[model samples]
Target chain A: MKARDLMRRDLTSVEPDTLVHEAVYIMEQSGLSTLPVVDEEGKLVGIITEHDLIQAALPEYFEMLHSVTFLPNLNQIQKRLKEMAFKPVSEYMKEVFSVHLDDEDLHIADLLIRKRLKQIPVVDGEGHLVGVIRRIDILSRLIR
Target chain B: MILTVTLNPTLDKFYWVEKLPLSLERVEEEILIRAYKSWGSAGGKGINVSVFLACMGVETVAMGFLAGHTGQIILRDLLEKGVTANFVWIEGENRTNVTIIEKGKEYHPVKIHEEGPRIPTHAQELFLKKYRRMLKRAEYVVLAGAIPPGIPETAYRELALEAKEAGVKAVVHAGRRALWEAVKTGPFFVKPDVREELVVGDMPVRTEEEIISAGKKAIEYGCSACLISHHVTGDILITPEGIWEYEIGVPPTAFKNLVGADDALVGGIIYKLLQGEEIPEAVRYGMAAGAASLEVEAKMCLSPAAIEQEMKSIKMEFKEPL
Candidate 1:
């Protein structure tokens, strides 16, 4: 199948300056882990994933824990959650490893499988937002 | 904190061949066999979940029966992976699950499962005793997979009861009698494939819509969550909160093998759950993990980096009730 056939036409995106909490909420509500980062012009600039948000939310002291521990440190957890609620997508969105709209669906699948990616943003020649290709969307084609 | 019991585990052997002809006298050689050495782990449903929980940095203990050379290998692998195991040594060899992949064809991997060790009555008693002792410390107990020939199907029900007595959350991942019996006790989770649901619940699960309905019904049967792993349609997760659907995308490269995809899915779900993700989020992680496992060489662990990357893009949606 072609990229246009597999990609979702309705785009859910976030501006580069959008708050991290808003991005997280969008992902949680839409059941999406990544969001395309767009500029004020609605042009694709980068992408953000749950992992980025997780790493951003990790406290400096988390790496020092050696034993199995529950999420007992509510103060630290809340502080990180608050930070994610305030920071902008521009601070954490990955600049590299994105796809364009003209790219073939197979090409997008290649990127997903090769890079082990979950979602790839599809943009126009001038970098305007167009669509999004997700792993499940591509996998659904296999059933057919 | 989590305990998984595996009775018959093995090192999966995967053979890849390109374009399998329906009936050929002597096909030319294009077959490639990749063997992955897995840790000494329990070979059933509970054990698989424990392996993943350990990988996700959870304090997990695995208990079950092991025997012969393959049994020893399972132990070695689990120890190396840092998973604590308390298995009863029995007589006989662990069985291997084989996958023959016909290249160029979609979903053409043929899986052949070997019968595992025969547990003597004495060993069975020992296992039950050990499990009872272990249940005291377990926060969650996952009873997974098929029972060996000599074992009664009611074994899972008894275990579930014991877990319930200890105030531990029990998750059952089996079919037929075991699944039906577990449901009476109200398990934390029940994951049945469509065929199993059809046989056990007498429900039609031909399409995605039917599967979702059946899954909801399973939840109504006292399970906290119902997960259906479809052969072609991916997976559907149904919880009291809502229903979520996850579909797999074709990998960039042609699929090499799908031998451990379901196990990988189980692993992914446990991994996410340990990370404190909700049921829906855990299912997405499981789907990505299952899909990623299809691209791996053999019985190896699904790449964590790959899963993390896939987690970023995998899409899931709540299914509106029809």
Candidate 2:
């Protein structure tokens, strides 16, 4: 099977200027962990995932705390989240990583496993977004 | 893509009522009235222009500050109408302009325009950043309409200058301070909004001579051309080379709604320009578009066919060389 056979065409995507809060709302409603970010021409540029959103709520230096027990106050996290809500998705979207439709299903599954990605965007030869294939899609094929 | 900016956008709500009470005599009573028909749409000079352009199958992106629930409605409307959205989200509710048209007074609709949200410093910064990025793909950037609260008076000046830097042609459709600021940047064209006050910048535009002088002043300020609305049925275009008058055969009484006529004119001109037409011919098409919108009740007459039909009656006459 090829990636095209497993990819879902109807997907929720966002523009770079979409507010973080609105992006999160779309993600929740669509039940998707990630959203592809496209430009006005509908060309894929980046992706925003749940991990990126949670990371936006944490401070830059939080990772360097060496797993200390004493955590940052809730107020501080709330304040950071408030600021992030108004910022555009461009600030939080991850670097683009996509697979072409002609790519083999095995190759996509291997990349997904190695990269530990929940979903991978499917693009055409010209880099325009065509669809997205999720890890669950590959796993469900065995049951079917 | 044509990028149109409406810094202060509105959701226009229009109602067709049988009659509107002239006097509310009792202060304690909550008077109730019913409307036979009602409609709402995304509004703002730039948005109106975008709607018109989209109807003509032109790719246009509308950018500005949008806020609250009303902003969502406006964005949805723009998307449904085929105009790409790139608005910066801000805090506060977008204003809604209400118009009540009585059965016999369709020509004299009572309009109440609200003041929209105040843009904070951060939102303004974000908008400029997005604007610069979008300018990369735009053929022309149209700066139209009123400047909202908390925005600098030099907003149009800065935007026009940025468009110039980006090598994109800029068309400024504004009035008063915004018009004055943009005129200094030598935009491709300048259309002064003289609806509220018959004035452009500090000059009075009430008389034909004053309008000509004001247009000349704008030309002196570095604008390539200045188009001023002379009356309901005509407009005057002044360039460094010569002046031309554009008039439609329709009378004022023939207009169903004059609200979005100016925006259609600007949008029509840009649409024609994108089709590789010259400035004179584009302005003629734009006049026809304005006349077409005047005959309809919708914010803009969205049919290119209608605009073409109206174009047949447009009279363009060259007055004299400047």
Candidate 3:
């Protein structure tokens, strides 16, 4: 079927500059690994997945604590946490792997199979964000 | 630890034909029939994602509502794929999705979705309780797909809040009220396609610059990053650091079935995260996985080898918007 038929009209999205913690919450609530990053105009721009957020949150340094016989280094762990806390998702987000609307549903399917993506954005002719087609959506269609 | 919840799951039925006539005519006994049939298990978004993750060798748990003969099928499929599943038993059929493929030189498949059985209030409550318990053990909780009819839109929101309180990351892959409500909980990731965004009156996001701006706005609404999965152009990712874009070009092979591509993407991202790959690397893997899924028929996700092969040839360009 065409993308318009298979795509999900309702969607959850986020804009850039969103706090890493807040994005984490949205992902938890929605059960989505990736979110469409858009502009004030709602145009499709980039995508941020759970991997990106996790990478952004990775600690930059490890702290070394007072030497205890076999205990792990508390100071190093603290240092790492501090560095990670300061890091932003922007430093880790992927800048690519997005799809557009106007492209055929067949093309989209091919992209998904070739790219192995779970979700593909449906943008309007102007490249504005429109709908989303998830592998689940396609699977739902297949089973029905 | 990514936890996916599948209240109901099922095996997908795929029927292939040379072409779908508006009306079917009976063929004579002498005439030969040309068609193909295939089956794969799928139900909620969570299960689909888990299947992909398992294929990619990512450790994951698939939980949710289950019952009836169809539920057995789902369990069998999960076991076959080596995915860990923990489902609460209930009454009713698990549900099914049908795919009709019109096979010419090119195959065109039409998907018909079946609404699952209504989830009783008590069962829903029990599932929620179980989910809350599971959330504590997970680093990431994925609440995927549409909640059965009779379920409240606020269900995802409540679950998300619970996860957050427990210091777990939440990922929501839902639509409409469910999606809007979940956003208030401040999830780590929100994946919305263009159509879903437009339905929410959050459209007009065109161009890379516009998408970046929108991603920033979503973060203001309590999202860590916004991943816009476009159909035609590519993808737009907005995070606290900055905005980035990836354009998915045409695939090398012809279209077979569009099913399971997104699940492949999810699987790819989760695999990378578990492996400690950075976001950019994860995106590449996700893109490759999605592309590979497109090449296969039915709802089956592509193999890792296929994904890796595609990853090597795929190229993505990054540019700073003016």
Candidate 4:
């Protein structure tokens, strides 16, 4: 089946001007860990994933830490989060890798496995967002 | 930011067909009716208002209940129009309201609307929580359209009251019980839906005198302003200061579609209000937006230039209430 056939078209997207807090609320409500950031022209500009938000909230020297428990207190992390909460998503949103509607399911599955992505945004010929294809969607469709 | 609530939203699908058969007599045989053109957009009274406001560069967030596959299409369209979505996902499917326009009969399109999904108790609670959070950032909140099943009719009242507590101006663009309920909370503005009924509760708005009386009654109920439709090309606005008549100089025959004209009017007014324009001037811009929408094939007048041009043909006259 084509990506269009198995894609979950019900995903909600965020705009670039959307605040980080608002984006988090939408993600929580929709049960989505990643949200495609779309611009006014309906083009997919970026994506806000759980990992991206975590990186923004974490200290700059987080990767250098021996362990997460090595942190003295969460005050540093809390302050970072509060400061980033009101900022626009565009500040922290990362570039998104996408697939077209006509892309073969096997190619999408391969990309998901190689890239370790949970979901890939689907765009039309003009790069307008169509929907998204999750790893589970392809697996379930293939199994069926 | 302007926040809009549409309890019952739909995916408005417009199809241009050569003809619409009165009946399908052959039940056993397969029949095919082809459409030459088709368009779909997010629709609901408040949703339409949000879309128009977004197009005008006003920050707007649309809050409502969305469900199933139909909800997906609605969300995509909303994002495309630049309106932020903060809807609660519920069980069942969102509605698909179809408008079939026959060739040369563009003025009179056949509309078929489905009653949308019922809002469960949990969904209602979740929506209120989200609404309160959104209210903190909203300068104005618009409660519009019909109240869907499983949701209380007093929902708008509760919301308007909360907005009042938050110091956010509330605009109620609904009719019947929903209008009456929200009016009691003393909204910033109330525009009664006169399409289904010519009354705000028991108040008759069929005649000019009666329309003024209805508007007065709502104002007496604590609303700042009350706007009622007078005719196809005219509407009457009543506020504490005085009454004003808005009329577009163009003939009614110039209208091609009247679907989202009222929404455009409300949105235009809010857009101007956000720009610090007074109520009268804002309403004038709104009337022009409605007139512009009337002349277009699309549901709304998307071009700011078109609305500006239509303003030249709109005339606003003040009057003493009878």
Which candidate leads the pack in TM-score? 2
For model 4, the chain A TM-score is 0.94
In model 4, state the lDDT of residue B136.
76
Tens digits of per-residue lDDT, candidate 4, B175-205, equal 8898898898889999999888888868889
CA RMSD of each candidate after superposition: 20.9, 7.1, 21.6, 11.8
Docking class of 2: incorrect
Higher-TM-score candidate of 1 and 3: 3
Residue B299 CA displacement from its true place in model 3, Å: 2.3
Tens digits of lDDT, candidate 1, A1-144 = 566556664345666777887677656544557878766555778989898877766776666763227456667766877867887888888984666755776778889999888878776676766567779888888777
Error of 3 at B53 (Å): 1.4
Q: Which of the two, 2 or 3, has more TM-score? A: 2
**After TM-score superposition, what is the CA distance of residue B32 in candidate 4 from its true location, in Å?**
5.7
Candidate 4's TM-score reads 0.71
Q: How accurate is candidate 3 locally (lDDT)?
A: 0.65
TM for every model, in the order presented, reads: 0.61, 0.78, 0.63, 0.71
Q: What lDDT does candidate 1 reach at residue B73? A: 71
Instruction: Give the higher-DockQ candidate: 3 or 4.
Output: 4
How accurate locally is residue B19 in candidate 2, as Cα lDDT from 0 to 100? 86
Error of 2 at B42 (Å): 0.9
Candidate 2 Cα errors over 4 Å, as ranges: A1-45, A55-144, B25-29
Error of 1 at A72 (Å): 68
